[model samples]
Structure formats: structure tokens, C-alpha cells
Target chain A: MTAKAAMRKQFTLNPAALEQLFSVLESHDFQIVGPTIRNGTIQYDYIKGCKELPSGWTSEQERASCRLKRRKDDALFGYVPGADSLKRFLHPPELRLFRAERENGVFRILDNPAPAPKLAFVGVRSCELRALSILDRVLAEDRYPDAAYVAARRRIFIVAVNCTEPAPTCFCTSMGGGPEAGGGFDLLLTEIVSDNQHVFVAEAGTSEGSGVLAVLNPGEVTKEIMAALHEAMDRSKAAFKREVATEGLRELLYESFDHPQWDRVAAQCFLCANCTMVCPTCFCVTVEDSTDVPVRRAERWRKWDSCFTQNFSYIHGGSVRLSPKSRYRQWLTHKMAAWVDQFGTFGCVGCGRCITWCPAGIDVTEQIAALRGTAAPAASDGAG
Target chain B: MNSDTGMKPKIAIFKFASCDGCQLSLLELEDSLLDLVNAVEIAYFPEASRRMLKGPYDIGLVEGSITTHHDAERIQRVRRESKTLVTIGACATAGGIQALRNWKDVGEFVRFVYAKPDFISTLKMSTPVAEHVPVDFELRGCPINKLHLVELIGAMLAGRKPNIPTYSVCMECKRRGNVCLAVSASLPCLGPVTQAGCGAICPAYHRACYGCFGPMENPNPTALAGRFEAQGHADRDIMRAFRMFNAWSWQFRQVSEERERR
Candidate 1:
């Protein structure tokens, strides 16, 4: 499906307006984090201004591979999503839940009182926005809501960008997420960099976004600029090389629970939890309590965890998922099938971070396809 | 809570055939040393106080592997005396780098290196403390993390389990925001199979992990070795990786031996 241009809210802005947008977010006391080159890859980090963006840089990504290459034009959002996602800001890797101290034979429990940082996430893709909402369902909207996640999530201001150049690993088109910006962004942009023109076609999704746009007062969207935006969107839609056939995928995954394909995939899997770590929506966490001997102080910390870990399934007797095959099955089954039952949506957004970041180069799309073809014959049904 | 004697829990440090780097980690805890001393009596640590307090006491921190007949018998006696025995470092837990001799003939090495081959007496294989005696817990790493050493002692005193994670080193590397060298640069790394606790020191510096902390709780070294092979690494290179500090660790040993056979 082509990205429909929001005609009424669209405005054209020169390259300089992006720097002004940074200034606008900064004045409001938002810590701006966006894509920047660090340690030979584009990762989300604190940007001083638009200058910190990885301009004139594009990354080539495949299964278990990503390498940064110089683009012909100096496009800010030229590359696809990096290894990092918005999860790092909203749900931190490590968080102190509370601390208990003993003094004069009296024990006092103190909750963590650190304030959440107001964050303005720049260069957010549509799949990432979906990932944020998925996290919202898990952490904030669940029965026992995470106060920390809710607080941090409430203060975030999203600046979504439409993808013009899709990476080889990206399969967002098949999973109800595409290169176009969706409803969650405060301000959305489609970058158009050609020989004659280099500008951002902007649209405001929220009132605050329109306010920021009004301050910049960009020019009216012209016929030629809109044409270029359509071209970029069409190009991205056509470039998706990988896709998952999502039709009855939830049922297919359940039917293939005993499929031999699991063993084949498990043989290749490292069981390192890299896929879950890089995935934007994987939100499992584990808590640890530590004590300081001399001071008589105890603190509980929440750390990001994965289902792939043995301890993640540890019970009274032993680990439930003892084998690598069972652990891998739990992760994939939960993500594709059980997640729909729990959250009303598949856990994966098809951003392809898992594919590119995995050490074994395991492709989820290929695995799902394998399951669909040669799944163990149903006991009641006819032959495969 | 004190015992009937009204004294702190007695802690002893024992060494077998290690470099004593794990023992040095205790001294490296400069800021916490005084506090640790106050918490427990250093019953028998010849490395520090030269105090040779007898065992049959509390916790024993055993280091190194059983490389000789004398060391093997000593570990069994050490286990019999101590109320709780905890193995420290890769040497004590996974047999250390010296365990590479497990694949070779020690008698041949004695003849080559020593002037008097008859004088030297060593075990055929350098085996871990667990192979000789029952270990209550095992603290991994070539030279164990100073903070983890402190945590182990604190947990023992408090009658609780140590807050050590058994997950892969990749977890800590991702937490530190280090880009995957194996995925991005195609560098052969052992982080995927190695345990956490080193704070991913090697990967942060743009080098591959050498598996100093040993194989994690559930390591897939075979799959990781296959990945290394696919990356165009020679069988010798793959074999060298698994035959490091944790050479005799069954998970790593299986992969290294397979590579050697190939």
C-alpha cells in the first residue's frame, strides 16, 4: 500500500528548519536523542543538534550483517533503523526499584524518587512507533502498571520520519507497519533529497506539533514537492525484499508446535538472546536484590531480561525450558502466537533488528515460512 | 547474628595451581577491604596476613585447579573442613588455561622442559575443584570481578544467594551499548557463549571476548563455532577460542575437540 499524503496538514521546509526544530525541543527542556554514528555504526544517542545526525551516511543491512556506507547525498535519515530502539529510553536496561536501609536497629524502605527525563526522540520510524504502543500495552496498560514506564512514556515527544530507503532485512510491509509515519508522532516528515531540491515534507499529528511548525512557518507544500514525496514512498514500498505471510500465522505457529523445523532452527541458533535484546517490543525483565554488608543497606534492581535465558524459566525444581529447542520455541511461539492472545497484536513489528543483529544470521521470516510448508500433520486433519 | 562464640564468620582463602590473580582480587577491593575485615575474620589467607588459622570454620574461597596429586588430596581435605566451599575463578571452576594440557601428554612436556624428568610429578589432566570435591558455588572469570567477590562474601554472611547472573556476556554488552563486533564487523567473538560479570570489557574496546568468565548457564558453543566457521575462520582458530581459560569446561571442550578433529 502506498503512503497517503496528508494534504491538509502538509508543509515544505528547507534543510535548516530541522536545526530549528531541535532548538524548539531544547527550549522546552527535552533531551533530544537521535541516530548518530558511534563505534562504526548508526545508533541512537544524545545529539547536540542536527549536526550530530549521520548525514551522507547509509547503512547496508542483511541477515546478521550491517555496514555503514557513504551515500551520494547528505540525507539525515538516510539509513534504516539501527540496533537501538526507543525501549532504552522508556524502559531502561537497569533501574533501581527501591532501597532499604537499617539504622539504629530501625529499617526504612525508600522508593526510587528519581524523576523521569523528558525525551524528544528524533528519526523515529513507523515500526518503532508500533513497538512503543506494544510496550504501552505490556508495561503501562497491563494489570500491574509500571509507574516508571508510565511516567517516562508520558513525557516523550516523538518526531517520526518516513523511510525512503528500506534496508534489505526490513519486512515492515508484511506486518501491518510500513515506511510511512502512523498516528503516534507529534510531527512527521518525509525527506526528499534530489539534485534540484533538498527539503522535508512535514505534517503535524498533534497540536504541539502544529505549534512547532507554526513557529518555523515553512512554505506551502507545492505540487512538485508532493510528487517527489510520492516517488520516495513508492520506491520504499517496492524495495522490501523480505516478507512474512501473516495470514493465519498465529494458527500456523500453534499447529507447528511439534514441527521438526524447530530443531533445524535451534541447531543454528546461538540462544544468546541477541534477537530479543535488539527487538523493539521484547519487554521481559528480571529483578535482583543486593545488600551492602557493612552499611546494612539493601536495594532491589530491575534489569532487562530475555526468555532465552535459563533463569528466566527457573521454577522450584529446575529450568522449565532446559533445551535450546524449547527456549527458542518459547520465544518464537510467544512472539507470533501467544502475544496476539495476550495483547491483541503480534509482538514483532518486522523492523528486522533481530535479523541484522543476530550472530548466527537466523532469519525469522524464513523460519516462519519453513513452519508453514512442512508443519507436522495435525492429528485430526488430513495429510500435509 | 553471631555464633555461640560471639565472633564473625570465619573466611579462608585456599590456592591450588592458579596464578593467585583471583586472590589478588580480594586485595584490590581497597575501599571495601577494611569493611570486609570488620565483617569476617580472615581465618587463613597466607597471601595477605600470613595468618594460618585452621579450618573446620565457615566459608572457604578455593582457587586454581588440581594439577598435582598433592593439590588433589588437599582439595578433598579442604572441602571436608570448611562448612561451605565456594570455587573462585575459571581455574577452580572450569580448570583454567592450564587444562589445555588435558588434550596432550604431560609426561612429554616434563621431559622437554625439565632437566631431570624423574623429579617432576604432575597430574595428567588439570581438573577443576568440582571434579575433586563438591563445590557449594562457583565464581567464574579468569581473575574474578572484585565487586562479585565482595558480593559473594556478603551473600554468604547474610545467608542468601549471590546476585550473579548466568546469562551470556552479550546481555552486558548490549546493556553497555556496545555494537556487536561479531554481527557488524564479522569479528569472531565468544561473547555469545561466555557468561556475564566482566561488564563486557573486551567487546567495548572493539576486540572479541576471549571467554575469560567461561561458558554461560546455557551456552551453544557448537552453534557459535559453526558461525565462526561460516565467517571463514580456520578450525585451528575456532579451536583456540574454546581452548582458552575454560578449556576443560564440557561445553567449550566439546566444541574445541570437534574443531581439532576437523
Candidate 2:
């Protein structure tokens, strides 16, 4: 790497230069997966270029609610994180482990030969970046690592976007994650849009990122650019009025095992596994094996599982966490407390997916606060 | 009786009171049909074949609900004849849409709708096959997923547990990257309390899942009802949602009754 590429640098980019960034990735045969409008929500999908991005759309999120609305201006990264994150791409919902066939009564196993694709993930948020790091701790560095996850993580290039717009449900600030792109990205972008100009203040976090920017030859970051970046970030930071209160959270949750609050929450909890499925750091998986009777061929598949499912806790005779109360308690305690004991970091990055995607508006942050005795459980408004 | 049917396992398909859509799922297995035929001896299937063989069968795939007094008695004999009695479709598993009569007066309906009410021989309520006989397995869905039927047959032959997930439809929806209609569009969906089997077809096409597959393992329908209420769905509408294909399922039945009371 050149000396200039070795050192982290910042640059200013216009809409045209942003388009060039996509071209650079395309030139290297990277499949660009970014946020796009689908099913009345902004979700991640394969995109050809910035044209496919949800440019003029923004998401309105609340507890158990999300709706996409048209923005006055065409800002590419205007919305907060939706139902998807990098987890969908890195650790897919279903993956074939192996295929086995018996010939002459001798069984032979064949490893799934599907190669991981080179992926360029754009419009990644700060919480998502932390989520990836947290997932790496489980799926990559664990005693028994997931080979498929490792393979998928191998050829990924992240184009992280610093959040300037955080949803009402977002609590990244509480989980030690802020709107700013701290690290774990090749290139970082801070979108600054106004009536006059729509530009991105970009920075290289790696040599490869710098090399990509070198091709575009973006302008030097000016005073005006820094001011715009700071202004937008300040607005976002100020928006996070609520927090999880992580201080002594682990101990609090452990002590509150028999807390009546659990029953209250469970009363409205669907136990549908939506919270866990949408969770970025939830790496729990279950394996299924099926055989073709005629062909004498069998295959094993690993599928994403959730603690919310009764079958998830099944042990021989019956499931351990039988009640919805117990299941909800297990999920919250594990995410906030046990994850720290295991991974040295909390599981939740405060993405608020569990809140926004919950059929019942059972907010985790609110639950934590209620458990802490700082707030009373919201009176069951008769409608959850 | 096919006593000398060689080493191949004997399979029988029986129908009761249903739309025959579940049995059609078997015929819809265009490619797997040949493989299934080669793997098992289809001793009896009235829908597909005229050769009605008696049993002592290995696996009896029963479709539809026990709507008549005759069907209720017939299921007992079917259970005794088959080594493994597997109920297929919502009708046999949870009492199909026909079981909506369980909430109403069946006699009044027979009198009102039929010209010859005295001639009609019917039970007070439509009931699942499991109510009469101990079912070894119950393949769910209004028209059971063909892939699931194939998997069940394959597993029975292999002497292994079928890989049919009892988890909620939300699992499959998330796997398919379907934006939660309940959350995003405020559409009252039964996916949370419903079982996973249909590959989340309804949600994928931008409609709420109507719970055709029946209640999931440990379903929290009351909790889902609360959510629906929060979304401004009327109690009657919420009740009607559960009173669909698998309406007689106890989990869904209890919740629908609760809604009606309100």
C-alpha cells in the first residue's frame, strides 16, 4: 500500500463521485447489496447502482410500527435501519451444511461446494457495524465457529454510513453505539443534504478504501464539509432522548429473574421469534437432516432459530421454557446480561428492530427501565 | 389385502369431509410423484386409482375431518389397520373450515340449507381425526404443503422424525425477507400464532397470513389478539381471523371464543 493509502484520510464527494464509488466496486466484481423500497419498507437487496437506493424515501419507525414516506429532498441515506441488517447477508437464514449419499452400504459425505460471493454492503449504520463486530465474536471467534459465516465474512467490503437520522425506536446511543461510524468499515460516509447541495463527506478506514477513493479523486475535505457533518451528527445525537441504562444492567437482570414485570411483558409478547429473527447478533441455529428414500441421498441444513420458540428450548421429554413469560425473560436476560458473560459485550446494539418489528409494541428499552424501577410498566392500554 | 406386496412399505390415502385440495397436493408433486411411487406401494388411493386394496397397511395418510357419525367410526378402523396413522391437511389435523359449525347449530343449518334435512346423516360438530384415533403425525395446512407430504412419507420410510417445523409463520417470513405486514402496513396477520409450512406465501405476496396452517407450537393467540386490537381491528374482525381454515384448533378456538364474548 502507498503511504497516502496507509494513513486514514477524508475527502468530499458529490453525487457524481458517489456514483463512481459504485463503479469502483463493480470494476472489482462486487455484488452491491443496499437498502431499497420493497413491501412498503426499506429493505436490503441486490442493487446495480445508487439508482436503486431508496433515495427520496425515509422510514418512520415506532414501537411495533414502521412506514416509508417520501422525503422532500432526494437523500440516499435518510432512513434509519429497517428490518434487515448485515446478518441476512453474512449469516443467511438457511444454509446447507453437507450432502450425504450411501453407495454399496458405504456412506460418503459431500461438503456444500457453494462459494461465498464477494459482497459490497452499502448504507450500513453504526449499530449494524457494532452488530457485525458482536457477531464476529460469536460466529467467528467462538470455540466452535460457524464455517459458513466465516466464509461469508471473508470477502466482504463495508461502505458504512454515519447516521444523521435515528428512528424513535433506535437506542444505539444507550448501547455505547452512536450515530457516527466509529470503525469496522472500509469507507465511511456522512451524508449532508441541503437545498443548495447534496454531498457526502467521506473517509477511508482502510488502505483498500483509500485505493477506491483514489480512483475517484474526490476533493479535499473543506471547513464547510466538516461543519455540515458535525451539524447533522449533532441533530441525530440529540434525538436519542431514551437509553437502556446499561450501568449494573447485568446484575439487575440476574436479580430480576422472578420479576413480575416479565409476566406483564409476556402478556403482550407474541413469542413469534420476530425479535430474535430480526436481531443482528442472534446467532443461534438449529440443524435439520432430510433424506430422499429413493435416491439414498441425505442433506443437512442449518436454519436460524429463536429463543422465543418453544421448540428452541426442547429437551427430550419437553421444552424447558414452557411459558411465554419464561421465554421472554430468557431472551432479554441473555441479550443484556449473559451475552456479556460469554462475548465480553452486550448482544443488543440498540438497533430497535425488536421494538419496531414486534407485533405488540413491547419495547426492550422500556422494559429495562421498568425493571430498573425507574419507570412503571406502561398501563396495559387495553390494546397492548 | 396386499399381504404379499414384497419388501416395499404399503401406503393408503383416505378422505373424509374435505375439499379434496389436500389430496390434490399429492398429485401436484409432479417430479417427486415418480420417486414416491418407486419408494412405496400405493395400495389404495380412491382419488388417483380404482384399485382399492385392503390393509394391514404400513402408513395410512388420512385427509379431511370426521364430519359424519360414519366417518367417526371409520377412523377407528383405519387406525387399527395402519401401523402409522398420519393425518394430512387442516381438516384431519385441526378440523378444516367445515368445523366452523362447531360454533353454530349444525341441526339448524341442515334444516335451513338442505331440502331433505331428515335424510342427511351428520354429527353435531365437525371434528379432527385425532379426536377419534391417536394420530402418529399430523401434517398441517388447509391444503397441506406438497413438500411437507413428501418429507413425511420420506421420513416414515427412512424411520426418522420428519423435519416439519412447528415454529410460527414469522420464521419463514423473516427467512424470505418479507417485510412484516403486521408491523409495516398495520395488517392484522395471524402469522405470529400460526404454524410455519406454507413458506409464508400470503405474506410474500403482500397480504397478511390467514393462519391456514393452524396454531403454532405454544401459540400466544391472546397476545396476537391484543396486537390486533392495538392496530384498531374490531373484536369481531379479530374473531373472524381465527375462525378460518383451522378454526376448531383449540388454541385458535379458545381465542376466537374470547373475542366473541367481548
Candidate 3:
């Protein structure tokens, strides 16, 4: 049998067996990281087992607000991406490049050398996986490869969950990313909850995943389980409230640079850069050098930057995008148009984090709809 | 002057008509304070030490706002003596929270706050140091960030321009991967128009940005104000948001006036 066929063996894992999967990953010296409720928000952190997952909880997300709500049943991976992402662990917000110390007029530079930690990410969403893949392409380009990113990425083992309950903010379907995970995971899971049973239909995508499955010794994945998995995925696909039409979106954005819609959207944009910050694909950075008062020692560091910032396009004379209209235009057009030219794929994964997390409640779908001259769904007014 | 072979740069810290928060920020650099002392001569800093050194200083770190006639003249002397004049904190960079009085009558404010209103000698408008004298650079924040302060000192010592950003707080928020408090929660945030420095602290804690660091390079406060209006915010609330820490800042002042007109 082919490797793909052999790895495609599926089984139904009960709650106890799922716990064993965590133990198996632990045995391989991988620190298990998963979602947990902390400070009234879903944050990714170190977890011992499935107990740490946000069970019996769901998140209500809208433009600029997120709230954790109680669910009728206990579903571990019921929520979508929170404020945090794989970028935090991989690229990191602040990275020290090197430290320089002047000794006897001779400047000696010491490079920051830290090894990447081996981590097993549990309950990673499909859109997030697509985002990680997008980052992989950006950070691992032949011209300028990030050593830290490559190391962290190589050490990660993803445990993806196919969405049975996608958040209202989700539009992964339109982006051709999700509702169902296609690839880019070590193991994939589909949860099914019936009257008497709660089981996960597990499928291994790699040898490592299959090894963990072997340890779990799950029950046989009968035809009924397969049907349940399909039903769950379909339910998720139907749950998406918004859809972004990507057909000729690149060409449209490129041609409509001066669209009146730009001015309309710019009026609402705070240029606070929350959209770029929360975006899974947005990767801009800035460098800074710091030294002690005596100028004896200095260190260079790199931090995350955004296009929405005036200095991002600044040269010797002045900033390139002086007005909010131009800055908003630059960001949207880059994501929809220039990204395809640069990365060979659409920049946005239609995750809707940008829409839900906007303090102004600016919806990307609505903005795009305006650009396309189509009537969008009435913008959510925060009313139930 | 110490005429040793390795002559460290002479640095001084000055304050005007505001809180001493930014001066405390320099002391808050506990880890690097000793290193800083070793790198430069603290020629004059009343906040840190009592020993006041006369100037012809290499770097003058000015804090607070120009809110009195005495301060208005004092800054000119500071400008003449210092080779490089750097303004630290919102007060020195953009007139700070005290500038809110600029919209109203300062005399009324003096009468309300002080028992002896006639004894108070204050300018009608609280203004930044740059308004009176040329500033080499302006380090922004309510109390400027210690990291940026260190970077500024380091760059000055190295005889190079400091690498301070003119970006919005939105960039810092994104870098930290925090959700947008304004968009997600329908809160009024000035982060888009405010400069990046405070590391998006307010939003991380589920509060909107108050524009403590002032208007970023070429900000559009009118656009953000329109957003606030569309989100069912009252005109007064939108106006109050702009009239906070950086009220007297040109961009915010203009936007606030525009909203009032509307």
C-alpha cells in the first residue's frame, strides 16, 4: 500500500484514549500546548491533557468584542482563533539579534543563540494551519530565511481539529481553507457527540501521528462514524454567515485603487493596525539598536511592525502614505492584490479576526462588497 | 569639565509645567541605570540628585510642558546650552493631559484648583518644548518608555540618530497579537491616530486607547471620529475621546473642533 493509503487508517477515540494521545506526545519530549480559559478569554498555553481545553464554553465574537458563553454540551474545540496565534510562538514579538560590547576600543558582537522548543500544538484550527503555511512561505523564502522561525517551525507538531462548530466570525469556506481541514497536520480529528457517546474520529497524516494513534489503541472507525464526521463538517460549512467573493478580487483591487469605497472605509479605519496585528498572514517587522549609557554595550532587536504605521513607508524626506485614505488603500490593496503577486496566493484566509476584533467594527467582507458594488449584509450593530 | 582621555557625554534632565512622571521613567530603568551613569555624566538632574552641574551639556533631556512665562524663558537657555535637545514624555512632546485646559479658560481652571488664583502664574495654553525651541528628537508616551529612553541615550552616545518609530499603536498591538479593543468591543480607541510607544497596554487589558502618546505622523482623527459616530457613539463622547491626554495636539484639536461644529 502507498504511504498515503497506509496513513489513512482511521479509528474512533474515546475521551480516555484522547488523553493517552497527549501522553504519547509527552513521551516524545514535546510540550503539549492547547487552548484554555484565562482572564475571561481563550488563550493558548501549556496544558497537561484535554481537561485544559475550553470545554462547555463558546465564544461570542463581534467587531471589537469577544465574550465566552456557556454551551449546552461539553465540546472541547468549540471556539475559533482568539487574540493569540502560532505567530506568537514562532516569529515572536521581540527577538534579540545580537549584542555588541565595546572593550578597549574594539567592538565585540555576541549573537543571541537560543534553540527552538519542541512543541505539540493541540486543537489548531484549519484557518490557522493555512496561516502557518502562509507564514512558512514568507519566513522561509530563499532570499531572506529567518533562522529562528525555521527552527521553531521545524520543531512543531500540529494536531488539527476539523471544525464542527466554527465561530460566527469564520469565513474559511470562501477562502478555500476550512470548515474542514484538508492537510498540514500531523493528526486530524472530528468530534461527534450523540445521546450516549462522545468520540473523536482520528486520522493520522504522518508516521509520528500514526505512532501516537497506535499507543491510543482506538476502536474501529465504522461507516457510521464516517457519516457522522461528514455530517459535522457539513453543519460547520452551513454555519458561516459571511462569504467573501474572491473571484477576480485581485484584478478588481488592482484596478479600483481610486475607488470611492477607499474613502468610505478610510473614514472608519483608526489605522490602529489591529487588523494587521491579528491577521495570520500579515508579516511586517522593524529593527532597533539599543546601547548602555556609556556606549560600552549595545544590542540590536527586531519587533513586529505594521503597514498601517506611518513610519513603515517612511524615507528620508517624509512618509509615503501621508493620508489615512492612502494608508487604508495601501493595506487593503496589498492584502487583496499585491499579496498574490508577491506570495503566489491570496493574503487573506477569510478568518474574520480582522472584522471581529476591529474597535470600529469595520468588516472586510462589507468593504470588499462595497468595492464590488454589491449589497452587503447589514453591519452588526452589537444588538442581539 | 572632566578632561580625561575617555570623556563621557554630559547629560541633563529638565522639567516644566507637568507631572514628574517622565523623570521617574529614567529612574525606572533599574537594570540599566548603573550602566547609564557609567556611560554619561548626569550633569544636572534635580529628580535623581541634588548636585546641579552648569551647562554647555552634550544632551539635554527635557520633560513636561511650557505652561508658564518662567518656563518659556528657561527652555531658551536650555536650548542654547545643550548641543542636542531631546523632549521626553507627552508633556514635552505634545503638551500632555494639562493641555485639556487649552480648550477652556485657564483662569477658570486656576480658580477651581487653587485657593489663591492670583498667586498662580501660568500661560493661557500649555505647549510642548518644540513650540518654544528646536528639538533634535521627541520621545513620546505619557511617561516615555524606558526602552526607548535607553535607545535614545545609546544613539546620542554613539553620535547617531535615534531609531524611534512614528508608527501608530496599532502596529504594537498587532505585534503583540492582541485583539483590537475598539473593533471587537465597539470601544472608542485612538490607537490608529496615536503613536506607537505604550505597547498597546490599554487594549491588551480590554480598554480603548486614550491617545496618551499623541498624534502619530500625519494622523487622520476625523476619519476615526466618523467611525465612532457610525458606531452609535454620541458626538460629545467622540469629542471627549479626542480631548484627553493629547488634546492640544494639532490633529486631535482640529478633529475635536470639527466634531463640535457638526
Candidate 4:
């Protein structure tokens, strides 16, 4: 889809009037889940009014940087992503399948999938929107149809916001995913600051988006507004400080088994699994069951798993990947270059969550570059 | 013979040095778990069941490697107690990730990672159970392939040999019509040397095989490594690949050491 075709019937809302739009969105009977400063971080949650929004919020992230401070000026989407994207809400960490009930000599399992609420996720960044699309391919596709996720995803609305500022750890440009969302969202917003005006250029892609736009009674998208958005996206793209080349990356990465760089990184990796937890696309899971006090019945659940964990590779008599280096190799090689071969696309959204969230602060881009004779550059810190 | 006609085989799950991934694989079989439990007497699985029944177990599925001195002695007892002992993963068949210490001084590694080396008792190096006891069968994978695990258990139950591929991960990669990461992406893949069991999961997940399952029937480790170098990987990296999980296995050890020397 061309940028315009996916663009919603455009509308503009200045920063002063933005609160009215939030209230308008809240009043329209949709659950408004937007960004808020909770526990010293910008997290997505239900907001009752504009006061709940992180109005003057900004975040600082480095190789292992995480500090949130109020911005000197009001900028809604002026920060890097949190320890989360929208993955947790959409693809829950733990999913329970069905309940087993024994009746009349047969044990019947009832698959109790929750119906997704009419959720309006506000302030979603471009990469996050793309990450949702990857999740779309994994969960809602015709092949693996994750029934539980599909129900929640189908009737939802996405409010995508462009990134004017990029984190030092941010590298969405390399993976071809973000900074400016070209697709996946229902409505796209570009935060604009011109003199005294603080406005968001709004466009609707889906009909559900059209209905939401109509409620706000926002101005029609003008050619000037379109021009402004292009400028904004280009600025966002330029803001990217780190980039990974996805060019012949498949061959460049998948073919090289004897890369010296892996050991250097392996020496640093503790295999703590923080990277996978923060990653939006990783789907490794393990099942656990516990009886609810009454030992007669048991409830089983699937929990998030990371290949970095020692037990993840355990076979009957032993573990297959015996070393930290081996396990780390599997995870890195899979996410960056090999995911394309498996899923016909890159596994990473290039949000740099793995880098920033990693306690070790490993940069996948740096690791890949190292194999190609690129030395590890001096960084303020790293995320693993 | 008539009296034993209907008795189901008793199955016991065991663990070693590795993560609980192998046992978790069996547990992941949500729909089939109850049926599996119904078919076998789950005599013991310390990870799953607390009951430590004395075994002359019909089938013992051993999950890790002999990492500690106690584990070495324990495997001997298990060998005597079980009718069939199938080592589950890389750790059981070849000393696992912990085996990376096989190259370094054991005392140095022990003192480096642990707070007190004196309190810790370990073998000089990690080794697979097969080195200590006769193993009836061996299953390969980082985490044992749940599909293969189920089939193996079922085959034992029905008195037949389990159908497992003895070919390379390369074959499975081709069967799945996966774009050869090496041929297509020039990524450093270990498909040629790694065993076929993981079903090329890393490739399926958009990554190259890291040889989580060790050497296949006849792995051309040099050929794959040579291509990796051709694509710009250093000799240290090539050596590192073979020296990973299955470093002690003669097949992998020889190749990695040769590259290191060069």
C-alpha cells in the first residue's frame, strides 16, 4: 500500500487540543490504553483522562540505560519504548488453554479463549506497530492461527505515533521495520511542534479507524499536512544512530559457522534470558501445571521460555547446546539473519529492545558487524 | 507370556547437568500427556513427580550429562536399575555446554565461576553417560524433540524401534524446502555437522543451525567451516563452532583443535 492509501482520511490536532481528543476517545466507549509514567517508566495502560498521559515524559536509554525524566516541554511520543512494546497485552506471557471436567465417564476439555476487548492502544511507536504485524503473521495467520490472540487482535484499533527522537540503542533502520510506520496501524499520528503549536497529524487506514476519527471531528487531511508528515518521518529516520544492514545479511550471517566474534560476545553473555523477555518476537514457551489446593484437579499453563536457559536444550540424557557460547549462538543467529529463511522475513523488528534491555547490553548489530571485520565500537554501555 | 500380555511398560524420566528442557518437552504435550500417563506407569520423574520409587524400571529416559562425581556413580546405579536407558540430549550423549570447560583448566574454571572451589566436588571434566554405561538408545537435540520423544516412548511401548532420522540437519532443511542459509544468506550455519532432530528449528525460526544436536552420520565439518571462512569468518570462529557443546566428542574435537592450531 502506498503511504497515502494506508493513510487515514487525515486530520490535525494541536497539543493544546490533544487532551480534548483523549477525552473524546475515552468518552466514545472504547478502552483507551495509552502511555503513562508508572513505576518510573512509560508503560501502556488504561487512561481515564489526559492527566494520565505522560504529557511531559521523555526516556533515556543506552547500552544499558533506563531512566525516565519529565521533558522540559510537553511531547507525548517523545521517548524510546519501554521494557515492553505492545507484545504482552497482545500476546500474553502465560496462556491457559482449557479446563478439564469429568462428567459421565468421559473427561471433556473446554477451550476457554477470552474475547478481546475493543482496545484503542494510544501512542504506539512505528517499530511497535511493525512488531504487531510480525505478531500478526505469527498468531493470526491462516497457518498457525493462535485462536486466543486472534480474537483480541481482530476488533482492535492501533494508534501509531512517529519517533522524532531515537535511542542510542535504537536501530530500526537496519531491520527495515520502523521510525516511521508505513503500515499495520489503523490510525497514524505524527507529533508536530511548530512555534506555539503542538499538533498530531492523524490518518485512518481501516474503517474502525475512520469511525474513531469521525468522533474526534478533526480537520480533513490537507496536502500541507501530508508534506509535514513526510518531513517528520524523514527526520525520524535520520534520528536513528545505529543501523544493521539486512542486504545479503541472510548469506552473510547464516553461512558463517566459524565466526570468532561469537566467542567474544559469549564470554560476556551470562544467559540470564533478559533479552528474550524484552524481545517482541521471541515465542519459545514451556508448560507447567499445578493443582489448585484441591489435589484432585490440575490446571496447565504455557509460560515464556528462552533458548538461553540451560534447560531449554536439555535432551533425555543431556543438553544439546552444552556451552553458553552455543546457546547464545543459536539465539543471535536465529533472530537476525536466519528468521528470514524460516518465516520469510527478519525475526527482529529492530526496536533494539534486546540491546537496551540486556543487562550485558549486547548489540546484535555490533555482533554482526564484528564478523564482517567491524570492531566493537566504544558505547556508553550495552544491553543484553 | 500370557500373564504379562497386558502389562504396560513403566516409564521413568531422569535429569543430569542440563536444564529441564527435555522433561518440559514431555510436559508440553498437553493433549497427549494424559493419554501418555494412561499408557505407562510413570514410576519416577523427580522433576515431575516426587515419588522416588526403587526402580528396575522398564524404560529410563536420562536427560543430562555426568557433570559431578555423584552423577557418575548415580548413572551406574541407573544402568543397573533400568531395562533400557536412553540418553536424551547433547549433555547425555556428549558432555553439554558445561563441557566447554573441558579445554580450560578445571580448577581455574571451578574457582572462576563458583564462590568456593573447595566446597564443590566435580569430575575433572564433564562426560556423557554413554562413556560410563551401556545405553540402549540415544536421542539428540538441544532440548529433546518432543515429537521424537513421544514417538520413541510410543515405539518402546509397542515393541518396535523408534523412527529417528540419522541424517544431517541439512537433509531436514532441504526436506522443509528451507533456503540454505549458507547458499542463500551466506550465514555461518552448522547444518552439515549437526544431527537431524531439531527439524531445523533455528532455520524455521529464521536463524542458522548452531549444532545443538551434535555430529550427524557423516558430517563434513571442514567443508561447512571452509565455506564459513570463505564468507569472512576467522579461524578462531571456525574453531569456536566445533569447540562448542560437543567439544569432547572425537569427531568435533579433532576438527576444532586443528583449526585452533592453524
Which is the leading candidate under DockQ?
Answer: 2
Best by lDDT: 1
Candidate 1: tens digits of C-alpha lDDT, residues A88-204: 888988999999998887999977659999999999999999999999999999999999999999998999999999987888888998899777889898899988879998888
Candidate number 3, chain A TM-score: 0.95
Top-down DockQ ranking: 2, 1, 3, 4
Alpha-carbon lDDT of model 4: 0.72
**Residues B63-93, model 2: lDDT tens digits:** 9999888898899999999998999999999
DockQ, structure candidate 1: 0.57
Residue range with the least summed lDDT across 10 consecutive positions in model 3 chain A: A1-10
Per-model TM-score, in order, reads 0.96, 0.96, 0.91, 0.59
The TM-score that candidate 2 achieves is 0.96
The positional error of residue B62 in candidate 2, measured at the CA in angstroms, is 1.0
Say what the interface RMSD of candidate 1 is: 3.9
Go through the candidates in order and give each one's C-alpha lDDT: 0.89, 0.88, 0.82, 0.72
Residue range B139-207, candidate 4, lDDT tens digits: 887777887877777666545446565546654554343444443345677776677778777877658
Q: How close is candidate 1 to the true structure, as a TM-score?
A: 0.96
User: How close is each model in CA RMSD to the real structure?
Assistant: 3.9, 3.0, 3.1, 12.1
lDDT of 1 at A297: 84
